[model samples]
Target: MKILITGGAGFVGSALAIALKQNYPHYQVLALDNLKRRGSELNLSRLKAAGVEFTHGDIRSKEDFDALPAVDAVIEASAEPSVLAGLDGTPDYLINTNLFGTVNCLNYALKHKANFIFLSTSRVYPIKTIETLNFVEEATRFALSDEQPVPGVSAKGIAENFPLDGARSLYGTTKLASELLIQEYNEFYGLRTVINRCGVLTGPWQMGKVDQGVMVLWIAKHYFQQQLGYFGYGGTGKQIRDMLHVADLYRLIDWQLHHLDQVNGEILNVGGGLESSASLQELTQVCQEVTGHTIPIKAVAETRTADIRLYVTDNTKVTNLTGWKPEIGIRRIVEDITAWLAENEKDLAPILK
Candidate 1:
């Protein structure tokens, strides 16, 4: 089987490419990326060493896909993933990449008759709805109350059926719009597709920042002894998020590829679930324990317009269908990142710090 992963040089895309090639030596895995992310170029060497072919290309241009050979599947992983992407009043790049880029990838898949898998975001759920969910503030974190005002949400987390009426962020609107387009493609073009509405995905190789990849950003700050902050919810650091190790995501994608007929046209919520969730305050404790560094974290009571108080994936539907659950816990995830940073300290210090 042959696979094309858009944004293949990125942390998630590159990791998936390497894992697929390593597990299926005979399979051809090609990674096409523009290397727009700060640390993405670093993965080119890794991809080459893993016997994965790398192509320099942008998803925004249809001509870029023309240069690549036909494949059995396309994993649409490229995106301007920041939630605060267009708040600066410039949204052209984000819209073109996340929406139009996805259309280009879909066209490529359509031409090749390839299976499509979209990496959608939990942010597609409206922030207004999520922020209003009932929660209890514990000493360290905010816990979702069992009784929510909305359906498809519970103490376990938000599920796929959560209402999508309100406005998500600009970043999320693009993804949600892409999801709709993919569905249309599947219905009209007979395309086999699977959509994974993923929550915070973190592991090694992620170039995390404050706007996204917060799990890794938190660890990076502690590992590098950088000052951190609790920005919202009265600055108590109680906002909660569940994060999945990227490896776990790879496992699900692998299963979906093998069973596309079963999962096609299915939109599943994927994440670490409640068991793997942590609040920023809890994350700080873990980071301190892992890095053995104690740093003062500033408190800012003001919340970002795009920020949500809590988001945990309700993975029940996916787990029930595929029997797949995240094996790596929050602590293990932190430990793995710490180890990655330590081993690559010389190379990563400038980038991560």
Candidate 2:
């Protein structure tokens, strides 16, 4: 089988490409990336070393896909990814890349008759709705109340049936819009497609930043003895999110490829679930334990408009169908990232620190 991965040089994209190639040497894998993210260019060598072909191209341009050959599948992983994007008065890049670029990818898939797999964001759920969830404050984190006033949410976390009304952020808006488009393509064009509404996905090689990939960002800050801050929810550092290792995601995608008929037209929520969730304070403690650094963290009472206090995926839907669940816990995720950072300190310090 031949595969094309957009954002192929990115953390998730590159990791998926390398894993697929390593596990199935007979499968031809091509990774196309614009390398817009800071540390993405670093993955070119890793991709090549793993026997995955790399192409420097932007999905925003239709002409870029003209040079590529037909593939059996197209993994749409390219996006701006930052929730804070366009708040500084620049929506062009986020919208064009996340929405328009997806359309271009869809066209490419249509032309090739390839199965489409979209990596959508959990941000597609309304922020206001999630904020309304009831929770109790624990010493290190916030725990969801057993009962929720909202549908499709509970202590188990947010489910696939969560209501999708209200503002979720410009970054999320584009992804949700793209999801609608993908559904249309699947219905109208008869393209086989599956959408995974993923929560925080992190692992080694992710160039994490404050706006996204906060798990790795948290570890990186502590690893280098850098100061950190909690900006929302009265600055108590109680905001929480579930994390999924990229390897776990790769396993699911691999299974989906083999069982596309079963998962076709399915929109499932994917994440590490409640078992792998952590609050900022909890993550800080873990980071301190792993990195052996005790850095002071500043707390600000003001909440970012685009920020949500908690988002855990209830993976019952996907788990039942695919029999897949994230095996890596928060500490394990941190350990892996720490190891990667330590191994490549000389090369990563400038970017991560």
Candidate 3:
């Protein structure tokens, strides 16, 4: 199979490429990215060294899409994934890169008659509905219901059925728009399209940025000697998040490729579920335990725009459909992130600036 992955030089995209090459050796993987992010070049360089084909191109440019090699599948991983960056009269980049970029990708997919997979985010859910959640504070984290059921088993976490139109932030709006675009393309072109509304994805080869990979940044700072900052503490330092390893997503996409007819035009919330969740305080403690450091913690004045209070995904739909769930835990997440940092410390130096 010939596969083309956009944003393949970024964290999730690069790791997906590595996972595909390792697991499906007969398949040919072509990664396309602008390499605009700091250290994205490093990602592409590493992939090239590993024998993956690549093209230096921006999704915003039509010529880039036209130039793409024919492929059996197209993974639309490209996006300006900074929620906060979109708030400061700068959402155009998000729309251009995410919305318009997706249009280009879908068009390319239809033109080539290839299957499409889009990498969406949980942030597509509006912040108002999440804020209205009546979560209670626990010793280590926040519980959705007063009953405090086990992790990965709460209805309060955003499910695929949640109302999506609750005062979306700029970032959320674009993602939501792109999601619509994927569906529309599927209807209009008969394209086999799958939408995975992914939550926090972290693993090796990620140049974790503040806007996109918050969890990875926290892990990198705590264990890898990078500087760290906490925006809010009064949320009890337990603002919970469901994080999944990128490898798990590789499995999902692999499954989708095989069941193209079954998975097409379906939207699924993909994540670590309730079982693989953590808060700022809990993450800090884990970092301390693993790194034997204080893991400095501080507080800021207010929450960033559209910061969800306790964002976890039900992930039951994907589980039911593909029998896929997170195989890695938070502990393994930290260990692998630390290992990635140690292995690529020299290459990551540019982004550390």
What's the TM-score of every candidate structure?
A: 0.99, 0.99, 0.94
lDDT of each: 0.94, 0.94, 0.80
Best candidate, lDDT-wise? 1
Off by over 4 Å in 3: 146-156, 224-229, 233-235
Candidates 2 and 3 compared by lDDT, better number? 2
Q: How much is the lDDT of residue 2 in candidate 1?
A: 97
Per-residue lDDT of candidate 1, residues 1-353 (tens digit):
99999999998999999999999999999999999999999999999999999999999999999899999999999999999999899999999999999999999999999999999999999989988999987888898999999999999999999999999999999999999999999999999999999999999999999888888889999999989999988999999999999999999999998999988899999999999999999999999999999988999999978899999999999999999999999999999999999998888888889
lDDT of 2 by residue, 191-255 (tens): 99999999999999999899998988999999989999999899999999999999999999999
Regions of candidate 1 where Cα sits further than 4 Å from its true position: none
Better of 1 and 3 by lDDT: 1
TM-score, cand. 2 vs. native: 0.99
What is the model-wide C-alpha lDDT for candidate 2? Answer: 0.94
C-alpha lDDT of candidate 3 relative to the true structure: 0.80
